[model samples]
Target chain A: MKDVFKPEFVKLELEATTREEVLRELVDLLPVGDDKKELIYQRLLERENLGTTGIGKGIAIPHSRTLALKDVFVIVGRSKKGVDFNALDGKPVHLFFLIVAPPYDPKNRYLITLGKIAEISRELTRKKEWMEIEKKEEFVKFLNGLLREKK
Target chain B: MNKQLLFLISLQELDILIKEKEKEEEMGFPIKPCEELKKAREKIIEKIDAHLMRRYERLSERYGNPVVPVVDGICQGCYMLLPTSLISQKAKNERIHTCPNCGRFLYWVDD
Candidate 1:
């Protein structure tokens, strides 16, 4: 596990009204100035258009690779009321992991993040624990613990 | 066997189970699975399988003709650079080697 993720990068209580709304909100959370905002937004939109990021089990991992950033940043969000995300499970999504990485990176960090999300999504779905999480720090701690897991 | 295969097998089993339940429901009494329930189950299974298959095929080609292991923090698939600590820790068998760059699970292989 690399130390690429920081606590500040995580966003909690994202008030997204819909799937598209959440996607836009996630793009806004990326660390990019006005000069690079549009470029990053477009890249993310392009990836979404390619396919829905909803991985079912009420979770979505939206990610993209762009030159707009110097490094990778991830944002974790939760919707208390759940948002219509077009998930295959037909359940509203409450968990989201939005990732943005530099295009020049030799490896596919996006896929790795997706894999990590997938691994946890299955367990979380089984436990239905997303609804039980009450505070933002708790969410962050859960993710940190997950990152610390061996293998 | 890849993860996609596992997903497909699980989905197929669910589909069959749902159908059996639906047949029982049609006999007059409601059961664990019904016609409407079976349809929904089939739809979900199809979507998941299609999504996984599409991604697996696309990524398999993008990385290389054959899937390569990430070993000693290096992408045996491409021999790209990885973190020194990652490789060292993996060499000591203290932790699994994941490509710092690719994030794929690394495996030690002899050529």
Candidate 2:
């Protein structure tokens, strides 16, 4: 699970201004082909339409289960200038966690991964750590340490 | 993945959206017009092979989904193990493949 959210998947500076662009940039990090990427993007958009995945406090965890993927992959992107992601608190989002999983995962590991991310997001938001992220490694270390503490 | 595979994937996505829209209508939810989905489906159908398209329509009519991913040589749609001959590394990708048991379009999810 720790390997899923590696440093390479972490974007220190997200350039997208709108929610849609942010989602697109995050999807681009996935190692899927163009068609699968498009399908995943559409699924994410559909999920957002249901209600924002932005769980609040400057943190958003957008996720979906799709046929486009085989493994549960996580991509973390941070927007220095927050983007309005239609969060529950109606605040701009600085930390974005995009989690995708195959629809027919036998073990349903992605659900557990999503829960972990939500918990981490709450902690990050409460501490306002997103604002203090000066380096990608720092954020990664903090998240990994928090995740380790939960075990 | 070939262009045909990509087309099938896109078509599958459109069908899913159409199904969702229909389901929303069935639940009496206030839904917007889905003309875009309809048009997108038509466009994708035109791109794929006619025989494959016909098979997809038939399967979709009988079942809710006409396409499913293959994970570790197992069909996600019907949970059936695909033949080794079909899932072999040397199998040609020039033509599209379907699950023999459930007849759903198959896409390989190589981890």
Candidate 3:
């Protein structure tokens, strides 16, 4: 998680007001070029179209496995003003965890990280303290705390 | 990019999604088979060149990925260096190219 989760990928306050915009904003956090970013964006959009990754509890995990990605990437974004993501519980999503992985995942890192994010989201539902994190660094630390809690 | 090449990229994405979802379902995941995605694949199959489709099928049977992106002159499918002539194409995915090492369809992931 330390390798993938970085302060550079965290946004303290997301500016996108809609789900599509939010996905694009998260894609911008990726350390890839424009062509790959577009590919990743399309992959995430397609994944969302199949079924909303908005697993509710004020959080959403927009994930995809694409040839464009060389390895696993995780992005964290928070919206002060939540956006409707067609979530499971019909709630607007205030937090986003975007996962992008290469198609050749020998270690199942994508699935394992997804499970961890899902688990973290469940823990997030129990408290609103994550909202207090104003700095991206603080947010990463807060997430790291949640990841540590799962151990 | 050419229209057929564009479709190939989309087709690969659809195939990946279908494969992932199908595997999840096989593992007793609560995912239903997405018929819509399968139908979408059929539609794409009709538009592809016959010879290219044949090659794709043979490679896909051998390895799950038939089409993969090229980054830094490297084939993500086989992780081998692509030829300079192939990687030097400035137009970016305007023509169909296959990795000499693995024979998987290649699309440039970086312009």
Regions of model 1 farther than 4 Å from truth: A3-5, B1-111
Best by lDDT: 3
Q: Which run of 10 residues does model 2 chain A get worst, by summed lDDT?
A: A103-112
Give the TM-score of each candidate.
0.53, 0.69, 0.88
Instruction: Output the better candidate (1/2) by TM-score.
Output: 2
User: Model 3, range B18-111, lDDT digits (tens) per residue?
Assistant: 7678554433233335777788788988999999888888988998788887877888789999888777768867788888999988877665
lDDT rank, highest first? 3, 2, 1
**Candidate 2, residues B1-111: lDDT per residue as tens digits?**
566766776666556545555543342223336765566567778888888778877987888678787777898899899998888855334457888999888877662
Q: List pairs with backbone clashes in candidate 2.
A: none
Q: What is the C-alpha local distance difference test score of each model? A: 0.57, 0.75, 0.81
Which pairs clash (backbone N, Cα, C closer than 3 Å) in model 1?
Answer: B70-B106
> Which lDDT tens digits does candidate 1 get at residues A1-151?
6643456665567788887788777777666665356555655564554445676777877766554454667887778778887666678888887877653345756556656655666677786665677666776777666666725
Which 10-residue span in candidate 1 chain A carries the lowest summed lDDT? Answer: A43-52
Q: Which 10-residue window in model 3 chain B sums to the lowest lDDT?
A: B24-33
Q: What are the per-residue Cα lDDT tens digits for candidate 2 across A18-130?
A: 99999999999888888668878988896677557777778888877777787889899998899999887899999999988875456767666777777666678777765
CAPRI verdict (incorrect, acceptable, medium, high) for model 3: acceptable
Residue A122 local lDDT, model 2: 62
